[model samples]
Target: MNTADRVDLVTRYTQEVVTDEELAELLEEDSPSAYIGYAPTGEMHIGHFTTMRKLADFLQAGVDVTVLIADLHAHLDDEKSPFDLLDARSAYYEEAIEGMIEAAGADPDDIDFVRGTEFQLEEEYTLEMYRMAAETTISRTQRAASEVVRESESPNLGGLIYPLMQNLDVKSLDADIAYGGIDQRGIYMLGREILPNHGGESPVCLFAPLLAGLSGGKMSASEESSKVNLTDSPEEVADKINDAYCPMGEAEENGVLEYMEYLVFPILDERGENFVVERPEEYGGDLVYESYDALESDFVNEDLHPADLKGAAGEYVSEGIDPIRERLTEQPELLAEAYPDKYGDE
Candidate 1:
């Protein structure tokens, strides 16, 4: 693809890019590396889907994709995943990511997956970490890490070192573009500043939007009602979406509409399907949306009722998540072990 086409693809579902010029320059290179790292701390939900869908765009745009299962990062930041359970959590994360890639209509084999422990402890990487610590102040490090990590007034030294290591990861991975949700912006900006000091180029950054939870706030894995887990039963999904907070004729902060825009519409567009809002004939019959914009327009115009939108969203999202749910079903122990408190009975 040409630069413009590549730029469109890379920025398709993203909320922001560090610099359009930098991204355009990256596309000119032959298979420039792009990577996103995820700490294995929680169950992968629709929020993860919204972010990971950007990978499909990158792959199609000819950018090399790398997924970092940042197990050590999790341990470093407040020890979110306990030391013993890190392995299980990482395993579950990788499996879930691969399933998401396939569900997004992208070839999972085209992407590279790496665990932090694979090379993070190496002599060279550790040396760089120490170097960064010397130059970066404690306050700056903590500030850079604040949004990406759990904040504590009496924060541990590990949290202080977390942001520095993250900046180094862009260098160690040899990525041309650092990809993640907007919450990682602080860390990536720090990387652009310090990477040159470590013999690495300034990276182009791409950030996807952080999806709102079904309950009208940020999704939390600890709260089952906040978002739909990939392992949720069909009945469970329907119930959650049905009860979700989607105000009539208002798109702002409407999690149901956000799902349709971010997840349902993209999947439908890919599959050559329409967004069908089923309704009885007497109630103006079923409405079909050729695109998300069309659906949103109708929704804003009050042509679509909240109940119908929620019902349609539940069905469409369930279809999109079906394959991943099936894959997880085969390995019940993965979820059962990774999050025993939530899925142990499975």
Candidate 2:
């Protein structure tokens, strides 16, 4: 696919552009294009879907894609200290990646799952990684990656090397673009500078909006209330949505309701006149929006009832996720067995 097509996918997820001219040049170049990936470090959280969907969009556009299962980085970003062996963590990370790939309907065969430690040891990758670490300052790296690092309990040597490894992945993959969450903007910038020094071109960084957790802050696997896992049953999904803290006329602050505005609404808007995905006739929802103004008018006026909105949002989540969830069920034993203490039974 050309740069414009790649840009479209990025816009759909991130709603912004980093570099227009460079993207166009890459598109014009006759070389095949691919996207770089990071490992599924923890439980496959809602935030990961942004990158996954970006990959799907790229695949649909016929771009070559490389997915690196960053087994090494998982240790750095893991919500806890690494075990002495590291094998268990790696195994879990791989399972999460497999489950995620299956859930997304992405072809496992088409992707490359590189363990981060193995990639790090390669002489070429090692040289590139250090080269990036040298060129970028501690301050810049910290600034770009503050969200993850700041939240980390043990920001040690592994954490510092984590960013460099990410930058090198793009160089080693020789990808035309990189996909990540908005949170990874720092790593992408570091890659922009570090990769070029290692004789690789800078890639256009595309990001997706972070989905809100059920409890309202950014969706995190750490907080069960904040997210509905892909493994969640239909009843579980519905219960979470029903319990969603959507105050009337305040969808922005409420995470579950905001998902309807952010993720579901954009997809609905793209459908033009017959956006039944958000406004199913079953709920008296038939949004006729020729422009953003009309849609905003309806939303601000509360023309869309909260129940219909929530129900439609629930329906969208249920329907859109069925295929992926089915893929997840195939590996029941692999899911995170521990639920949040409160909702463990559900």
TM-score winner: 1
Candidate 2, residues 65-153, lDDT tens digits: the string is: 77776666766654342433245445545555555555555665666666666667788778767766777776677666776654445
**TM-score, structure 2 vs. true:** 0.80
Global lDDT of model 1: 0.89
lDDT of candidate 2 at residue 156, scale 0 to 100: 67
lDDT of 2 at 118: 66
Whole-model Cα lDDT of every candidate shown, in order: 0.89, 0.62
lDDT value for candidate 2? 0.62
Task: Give the lDDT of residue 318 in candidate 2.
Answer: 67
Reference-based TM-score of each model: 0.98, 0.80
True lDDT of residue 316, candidate 1: 83
Alpha-carbon deviation at 169 in model 2, angstroms = 1.3
Off by over 4 Å in 2: 1-6, 30-32, 78-108, 134-136, 150-154, 261-297, 336-346
Minimal lDDT window, size 10, model 1? 213-222
